[model samples]
Target: FEYAHETPKRNKRKNYLTITTGAPTKRSYLCVQSILYFLLLLNSVIAIIMWATNWYQLIIYKVQVLSNNSLNVELWKNPTWQPLLSIYIFNYTNVDRILEYSEKPNVKEIGPYVFREKANKVNVTFYQNGTVSYQVRRNYTFLPEKTRGSLNDIIYTPNVVLLSAAQMIKEKPWFVRKTLGALISATKVSAFNNFTVNDFIMGPEDWFSKIGLNLKRALGEDVPSKFGLLTKRMGLSGNFTMNTGKYNTDLVGQFEYIDGRPGLGKWEDEECDK
Candidate 1:
């Protein structure tokens, strides 16, 4: 009777032990499942955020194109023409700057004009006389260094605009002289109905000096001739003046206040010395 009673107690203890162990196992499984669900939720949230942002950008880009004029094929193939077209299209479309050129030589002919958030606005015009002009307007208060090169490259790509004024004079001396004379004559005829070599050439010394200066500046060394100096000086002076602002009258008084200060010369360095 005592042994049978002990057997029932032993059986009861075994059942309790099993139930305690199983309780902990079920709790661990629940915890693991909860953590897995949280991780999946987090991943889904991140993916949704990325998709929303990208989709918004795409929609904005599409909406910005107001006209189909931007899809012209001739403008895409010609680098010289594309810059001007980009300026007009962007201005009319009221879109942010995003045009980019392709790098691959083969595709370079095709172009990869993409919009970037931070590009300068270029004013482009096509004249009735078959000339395409590009004017770059810097958005920043301070001027950027690369702006000049960018403008020149856009206008002067291969077979685009003709050579620089100095290059044209050198390569076609008679033609340049005749053209300059004709332009002066036409202007005079329209105004006072008279023209002369004096009006067109400035002076023989001035012409030679201007040409020599331009050549020297363009080639970056003296070419050992009167004409070379003229070209270099002319080109250098023209480029310098075009890039810089005119001196302020208020600054002139301040400059005169200094002892032994030089007056502003025709060029930029001279003005700095004052």
Candidate 2:
């Protein structure tokens, strides 16, 4: 029994290997941070490309001038000079950038643009029926040549009204129909941006449409729509401009007036505004 107990000897030791999680966790965290940096870079690039390029703003003024044969508007008659304004939208560059963009020249413009007026609509009878003659004329051009202001090429065409025939005014007398009163006016026009959301990729119109896309698309040329009555109204008129949807303006002068001209008084009296 003693010999048998001694023969059955064996070593029993517990050997163990441990795997730590810290290294794997650190690797995974680094990978996530790398992805985040890449995503941020891409987002910044997209934002830069979508920056605004061509910019335009328009201001419209409506003036209803009350005039009879005695005091017709005389401002338009002096051809020696003309009242006008001009804005040049470049081919993505301007006078300063001309050096940078010398090779690519695209000067777009809102030309020697100004409130040009139609000829006076006069039914003057100097001798009270000496010659019962009435004359009316209306024409519109985006920019006229040699006007007062920097002149540019006539790039845009306005809605022009050409009177083709005698307007059958009234049955009783020509004088009765013509004496109602005359209105002087200006305008703002509307049209769908050339692109939809589908084409918003780079269309300036699409960017502008952002002002009121749904309303503008539905209205589709709100100002032009009302143009039907412009040519046949109380007096002559001219046209074009802007994306701001506008409505008919109330008469300011006859009822109340705003001396639109600065440093000027009543245009009727040419006296300083008091």
How well is each residue in 183-258 modelled by candidate 1, as lDDT tens digits? Answer: 4455431111111222211222334345435544565653423331122222111111010101322221122312
TM-score of each: 0.17, 0.20
Error of 1 at 82 (Å): 24
The local distance difference test score of model 2 is 0.32
**lDDT winner:** 1
- Superposed by TM-score, candidate 2 places the C-alpha of residue 180 at a distance from the truth, in angstroms, of 46
Candidate 1 regions with alpha-carbon error over 4 angstroms: 1-11, 16-58, 62-122, 125-134, 137-211, 214-274
Q: Residue by residue across 1-274, what tens digits does model 2's lDDT show?
A: 3554456768887669776765557788999999999999999877665552222111122122222231222442222343333333222223333444454344554323343444553442222212122344444333445443343232222111111011322343555344311210122222111221112211223222333333233435233212222223324332211111123223222111222223234355544352
Model 2 spans with C-alpha error above 4 angstroms: 1-82, 93-138, 142-221, 225-252, 256-274
Candidate 1, residue 179: how far the Cα is off, in Å:
25
Candidate 1 root-mean-square deviation in Å: 25.3
